[model samples]
Target: MIHVVFNEPDVTVINQAIELDENLKGDVVLIRDDYAVGPIQNLYLGEGREARKQWWSAVLAGGDYDGKADSGEVDDYKTVAELVGTMRRNPDEIIWIWAAQNKHDVSGYYWLLHFMKEFQGRVFILYLNNLPFINEKGQLFYPTWLSTIPPKEFLKAKKLARPITLSEFEVDPDEWIRLANEGKQVRILEGGKKLSQYGEEYYDEELKKFITGDWQKASKVINQFLSKARQTTGDAYLLWRLKKIVSGEGYDVQGEMKAMKDFEVKQKVGQPA
Candidate 1:
């Protein structure tokens, strides 16, 4: 069996869990691209490689708010395609996808479904959208990602994996088409329904106000907000909002880079004080 997930952090957690529980020692493939936020035109069409290259070109051209392009982004997706090709060759191996409810995971799941149509292998998904989870404190919450669940809790969730029926894939292609065309930052739910789109206001309003009060670097502002706020928004989502604010408000791009560097340095040494 092959287990597939969206990001490196997820890969890390799953690997750790696999070490703890022998049942999860199957081949794990990490899809490193983020389909949630950029130009995804023709992403689900044609051969996955060429289409992915085109998409990467579009993303690179857009230039992230920090005015930098991740040169290795295209190579990362190529690696994912190679892994998927391996799955395609092993027609009898069951493929399990660990997907969350958010735009990142759901969007990636759609692309994965589109790519795996030719595989003769059975596909199963541990979809975590509406599923309720109990934290260590015994509080119930709908987790947006597998990273949010403790390793012990994840073992419990693994039992919920269900096989994907042909009908589900049949219904998703057109929905993927519609989603690729929409060009919005949002998630597609079950049965082709769109999730509520999050806007600038969706961010912590107090954080935005705090940042506007002083000319701080984007990364610094984000770090400070995450430390002070009780919300659970992911760093990627916060960084995206920070870029939007920088571009919209004409903040310095160099400062954003410095802030990011400082944050990284702090992380390497110890948590920032």
Candidate 2:
């Protein structure tokens, strides 16, 4: 069975994967890092319900929710615990796909990935930036912090795949909703996953190694990389685009995608469809 836990939930890719096999209706699934359930930051989107509540609690406690951007740190919600509980309950399922925006707070994410890989599940990852790797005497090793992997080792997917820029993981939207209609679970998580990658000679291990111990550095590298990629990618605009295709109820896709924001959300979800 193919199970996908996409970070960004690309409509085209999600749709196409489901089309790859009818069983995808039952095969694919999703889960989040226990940290994901907390209030989001750095990125400029509204928080999820859990995050909103926590933010207000801080305000009530006089801890400050509307602090200046560059001011002192705000305590984040502990969604990682929530994610951990979910994984412990369903450890057998192999994850065909997954993603993350940061690495330091990803123990739950990495633990699950290793478990799935050990079980020989098809594993694919869509990290915000390139998956980390180290080279030793022509050996390529990607480190997973959940468990300390040795420096000169290698871990390739036995039945797993991940999205890289030149070779992105693809899924089709129309097909995904079809599976959703069939009583299968294809959830639209509250936020989106914007993906990018780098490898080969560009794997700059020296200046970037601090990423293994520091999220600020890793996040900085990824942001710098993606800011440049956007010069070419023009942004997939996943949420806006996906809603456009879905609003048509499978109609007017061509014209809808290029329309202005006002038009995209103009059609209601169940308007006589």
Candidate 3:
């Protein structure tokens, strides 16, 4: 058995749970990229390699957007392709997918389905986004990340995992293709339904207040804006938005807005307050 999960944190939590549960047996694989915010056209098609290359080129040009790579040499396309290779090698292994309802996890799930078409093994899913679980306080809550659930709760979820039916496989992949081509920031909810044009709800009105004066530091502006954010948005996404603002004359901030780890928004920034 093999368990496929999104992100490093999920891999850690699932591995820990599996170790404690003597009934569960499998190796864990992590899909380290966030598919929600990047280009997806032709990602599953024959031209996917070139398409991905172009997307990476743009991302690198837009300022440093290093994903959750252990080193500076991580290749998203190769990583996914390797997973496909693994499936081809062990066609009979039972593969379990643990995914949340967010675009990131849902998008990755669809990509996995696309790759698993040639696999001869059984596939099961533990979609936790909508599933309610009893927390430490004994209160039921819907968790957005697998890391949020305790090991005992995760074991329970594993027990309830079901095989992906043929009907689901047929319908869900088509929906995923449709959503992938739409090229919008969207959320994949229950039943493989897509809610398009998301993120507007999280737009902070206070962002405009930072545009005052001839120039302000982009780092300071981002800090100010995020301080009032209604939701927890990734620092990478916020920094990308700031770069777009600079490019569009929406604002001006100095210094090199590098990757998330080394990013620093310097002085002399201008934009609409």
Superposed Cα deviation of residue 214, candidate 2 (Å): 34
Question: Tens digits of per-residue lDDT for model 3 on 58-94?
Answer: 5555444554333435565676677777767876767
Q: Which structure among the candidates has the greatest TM-score?
A: 3
Model 3, which residues run further than 4 Å from truth?
A: 62-91, 136-139, 183-192, 197-233, 247-252, 259-273
lDDT of each: 0.63, 0.32, 0.65
Q: What global local distance difference test value does model 2 have?
A: 0.32
Q: Write the per-residue lDDT of candidate 2 for residues 1-273, one digit (tens) a residue.
A: 344443323333444545654544434344432322223232112434344445434322311223321242322222323433444567654344434333322322432432332233234454423345444345554432212222122132222344222222222222222322343211222223321222211222222221222223222333344454312111112222233234444222223323222121222334432
How many backbone collisions does model 2 have?
20
Relative to the unseen true structure, what is the C-alpha lDDT of residue 179 in candidate 2, on a scale of 0 to 100? 28
> Between prediction 1 and prediction 2, which has the larger lDDT?
1
Worst 10 residues of 2 by lDDT: 230-239
How far in Å is the alpha carbon of 187 misplaced in model 3?
A: 5.1
User: Model 1 scores what on Cα lDDT?
Assistant: 0.63
Q: What is the lDDT of candidate 3?
A: 0.65
RMSD to the hidden true structure, all candidates: 7.0, 20.5, 4.4
Question: How many clashes does the backbone of model 1 have?
Answer: 0
Per-prediction TM-score to the true structure, in the order listed: 0.71, 0.25, 0.76
- Counting only residues 3 or more apart in sequence or on different chains, how many pairs clash (N, Cα, C under 3 Å) in candidate 3? 7
Arranged by TM-score with the best first, the candidates are: 3, 1, 2
